[model samples]
Target: MEPKNNLRSLDRQINVFLPAISLICILCIFISCNKQDRTTVIYGKVTDQNHQAVDSILVVAGGLWDFNIEVVKQIYTDENGNYELVIDVPKKYIKLNV
Candidate 1:
């Protein structure tokens, strides 16, 4: 009867710790499963055939993922003819059209 009582006590202790252990494991999995966004910034200057700054020129950037083309950004050149395209994608998947 004493051994059985000890076993029951151990079982209760294990049950008490089980929820904490499960919560810790779930938290670890949640932390590890987060995906980080890889952002790439493309900087360029739009120019004309006469070697002049082309302001307000449309610059389009897309991401090639699998068989689909995702339009990442569409922006115009600033007053200085400079354009900056910030994309939340890897460099390998980026395509620019100016």
Candidate 2:
């Protein structure tokens, strides 16, 4: 009788622990897969052919990735005509619309 009772207790413990362990493993995998991608900074100055800093110019980063024209990020040139944008995109072919 004692042996039978011990077997049942062990089975119950395993049932509870197994489900918890499986849940933790699944959560870890989900978190790792959805991690944020690395970003690249695009900083430059906007100017006309006359070679002057064009202040207040709107800088746009747009392109079609996976068949869709999208604007990843935008920034306005400062007094020095300098703009910076940190965006996460593939390094294939992105359009720089200034």
Q: Please, what are the lDDT tens digits per residue for candidate 2 over residues 8-98?
A: 9999999999999999999999999867575768899888899898899988888666666778788899988899998777655344433
TM-score against native, each model:
0.54, 0.51
List runs of model 2 lying over 4 Å from the truth.
32-41, 47-52, 63-65, 86-98
Model 2 worst lDDT window (10 residues): 89-98
Report the number of the highest-TM-score candidate. 1
Clashing pairs in 1: none
**Candidate 1 residues 8-66, lDDT tens each?**
99999999999999999999998787655677788999888998999999888877766
* RMSD vs true structure, all candidates: 5.0, 5.3
Residue 16 lDDT, candidate 1, scale 0-100:
100
- For every model shown, the clashing-pair count is 0, 0
lDDT value, candidate 2, whole model: 0.81
